[model samples]
Target: MVTDRRSEFEATLTRTAEARGQEAGAALQRASLLRDAIHRFIRNRAAVVAAVAFVVMVGFVILTPWLSHGSAYGVDFAQAYKSPSWAHPFGTDEFGRDLLVRTALGGRVSIAIGFAATIAIMIVGILYGAISGFAGGRIDDMLMRFLDALYGLPYLPFAIITLAIFGTVNFWTMVVALTIASWFTTARVMRGQIITLKENDYVRAANALGARWYRVLFRHLLPNTLGVILIFVFLELPGVVLGEAFLSFIGLGISPPKASWGTLAQDGYSAYEAHPYIIIIPSLAIAWLILSAFFVADGLRDALDPRTRET
Candidate 1:
């Protein structure tokens, strides 16, 4: 009986050592992958430049309100339609509001909407997809069919309807509208990924070991989908920004006394013929942000690809 007990203790020790070894190996592999991804991202010059530009742009918007001498809302009729000068580098709009300050402030609103809406999309999409994929059978079919029904709805119109329902045109309102309209695609992508990942050996082993559903889903499945999720995030940002801009341009987004790149464009449109800088400046800002985001997304895609070699 003593010999048997000793053997059982030895087996337990062996099992514990193997488990530790596996955990250590996984940690090492994750570190190596992260290191390689960073190296790959750094090698992409366009991505590096774009990233720097994006950060600079974000900082410029965040700090502009504090640093600018002029107010975004304050009007000075005497300064109206002035060309780019030392006092106002981006010149003044028709109302003599400083274009530079307006542009910067508008950026804050636009970028904020983009990030907020994207975050909502990620949470809703990831959870819905994971649950549907993991559950499968009738539930999967029902959820997918509902998603398909949503897919048939037009994006802009749906957002507009949602906005109308909220009875306001503000930051949170716009975020909700965009989030409601945008989560469908993300959900589809995540669902496809989860469906494949759920069949992997690690996931099966997790189930076999009696791990809870949430643990298997969150700890095991979700982590594996990070690369795909990150790529989608960068790619989605530009779209959300543009969408916000479009809504604001149509007067359905940010209202008067507040600004967004889209609203700035709209304000500048009529006066563009007389003072092209009004429209040109904001348009260029929008283009710059979109291009930068796209480059970063491209870099992330290549970096995270397992097939990508160090060469």
Candidate 2:
């Protein structure tokens, strides 16, 4: 009886050791993958430059207003349309507001809206898609049909309607307007990924082990889809920025006295002929940000793709 008990104890010990070994191996593998992805991203020179430029631009926008100790709303007609000089590098706008300060402030608003809306989009899309895909029956069909219906709605017009319903067009309102229709694409992509991933052996094993639905979804499914999520975030940012800019340009976004890149461009539109730099500076800022975002997204795509990972 003692011998039998010892034998059982040994078997338990062996199983425990094997489990630890497997867990350690998985941890190492994950670390190696992350390291390789970073290396790949660093090797892409344009992406590296773009990432740096984006960080610099963000810092500039955030700090410029604070360091200048100036209000974006401050206007002085006497200094109106002053040419770029020692006092104001970007010159003055039609209202005689400092273009540099206003441009920086505008960037803050635009970038903030983009990020806030993108986060909201990701949260809604991920949860909806994950649940739908995992359920995989009438529920999936219903959810997908609803998403399809949303897809038919025109993006800008829908946003306009959303803003109208809120009876205001401000930061949070813009985020909601952008998030409403924009999440459809993300949901579709995530749903497709979840469907494919749910059939994997590990996922099946997780289910067989009686893990909770939320645990399986968050730990096993969503973790595996990180690559897709990261790529989508960078790709979506530029669209959100542009959308906010477009709405603001049309007088439905951030109101006057509050600056946004779109509003700055709108403010400068009529004066472009006599003072072309007013429009040119803000437009250039928008173009640079979009280009940088795209390059970073491309780099992340290549880095995270197993097929493209360097051996």
Candidate 3:
């Protein structure tokens, strides 16, 4: 009887231990899922760096007007063309204006233009492409052909002609010029994505169920293509900023009294011999902005690409 009781007790203990083992295994699985999510995010170091840089730069630019000492437009011929010194950090420009102040304010214009042009470009591209791609057949061909014709026009030549005809490159004019040329690339990308997505099983099911065309495209297609669109937006921003600069440099960008990085660089060119800081400072700002954008874009590419998803 003693031996039988001992065996029974051992069996009960074994069952309890087995139950505890199962509970521990379940806990481990939960922890593993959490770990996997964290690992996925941490794996993309480039993206993290880019994101951080962008945030810092953006914060700096937003606070620029308040951070400057003298007015961006305030001129002092007395301090004209001063080199970098304690009184003038980035020195004075040809017109005796503070280079640092102007550069700081210039950040607002450059960043604003980038965001404005991109938003406009994306809106037009997404709408036109979504419609054309959903319609398909002759409608798609016709729309694409029209876009192709527009694309064939040289951007520089057209910009020059418009500037000459307008006789002034104002803020709105710059936006218009950029908008005309920028949307084509986005439209093409969106259309291609839409084309592939329309034939997807879910899309087909939605169609079969008599779902509205707009609903199908906007609700289903747009979300899937969002990653691609975001990637393109980051990739294309530098180009827009550079284009704005080019126009400003050539006297076809923002008019004087309204400083842009490009126009500022142009202004500093004549006095670069005496005030190297004037040129160097603006040039460096532009470089940093472009480089930061590129880094953020690269990071987005890695993060968004399916091939690198596992990494």
Candidate 4:
């Protein structure tokens, strides 16, 4: 038996050697920045867990219709106001719609709005902030003053007033309202970061080399600020989701049959005294997701920040 084992080991080693001999040697490749970031991100256990949880919840939302009664919009007079039970896990709404289905659908809409608004914010905010910071002097002064003026205005009231002026609301309108309200901080943060980076030697060198200001900002500065930007994205998503919910709750957001979490919460609120689960379930879903987003943001900040790497 020992002799057979030795022979098998020798055969395995021989096979390995032959395979290596058959393969051509190549130059070692330099590590990529993106690869390094991925490695660092994976190493952050909290971030990974949060991201996994978030993904699973999203998957659950996507698959809920298939997994359950499979009808988000279908009203069943039979199941009206039913509490958590084997048939309907999340209970039913006043319209006899499945609460589980409605909540999942609401989550989808809420998450979509959050991401959409974030994208809008990132585009306008990053550009506005970068330009403001890079230009400095009078242009920066003017922009900063304008932003400050916008800041002093009562925010939610302004949004409510704007929505009222329009007289009718929908998903797109809600997203636009949220984006318009929420992008100020991102711009301010980006401007501050760009201002700090503007005087750096590399930025000056890029400018001296006749590289366009935009090119320098995009290529050299943005990459360096990516860590902060990504962290901001995670942190901002929850706020946007909550804001959409708030607007919808107040009837200033997506109206009628198109339900977001806010609308569901509003619908749930009326009967909550009698059937608490209807409201509680959607509320918990929102809270859990927002908390998960915060955890991801915190983890990303710690993992991605070069300044924090040494610690």
Best by TM-score: 1
**Across residues 109-206, which tens digit of lDDT does each residue of candidate 2 receive?**
99999999999999999889888998899999999999988889999999999999999988999999999958988888999999998887666655
For lDDT, the strongest prediction is 1
lDDT string for model 4 (1-311, tens) is 99999998998777555434322111011124445567777888888999998998899778887778645677778768888787878878877888887888888889998999898988888989999998999999999999999898776776677666667787777777777887899999999999997776656655655678778788777766776788899988998888888888877666667788888888888887898887788788888889889999988877666555443
Per residue, candidate 3 scores C-alpha lDDT tens digits across 1-311 of: 99999998998777656545544554574465445534554676776676677777777677756876755677778887778777677778767877777887777788788888888889999999989998999999999999999899987677677667766777777776777778888998899999998887666756755678988888767877876787778877877888888888877767678798888899988877866666777788777777777877776666565565453
Comparing candidate 1 with candidate 2, which one achieves the higher TM-score?
1
Off by over 4 Å in 2: 1-26, 69-71
Q: Global lDDT for candidate 4?
A: 0.79
- Per model, how many backbone clashes are there? 0, 0, 0, 0
TM-score of 3: 0.83
TM-score, every prediction: 0.92, 0.91, 0.83, 0.85
Which candidate do you rate higher for TM-score, 2 or 4?
A: 2
Check candidate 1 and list the clashing pairs. none
Candidate 2 clashes between residue pairs 3 or more apart in a chain or in different chains? none
Error of 3 at 21 (Å): 36
Q: Give the poorly placed runs of model 1, Cα more than 4 Å off.
A: 1-24
Worst 10 residues of 2 by lDDT: 18-27
TM-score, cand. 4 vs. native: 0.85
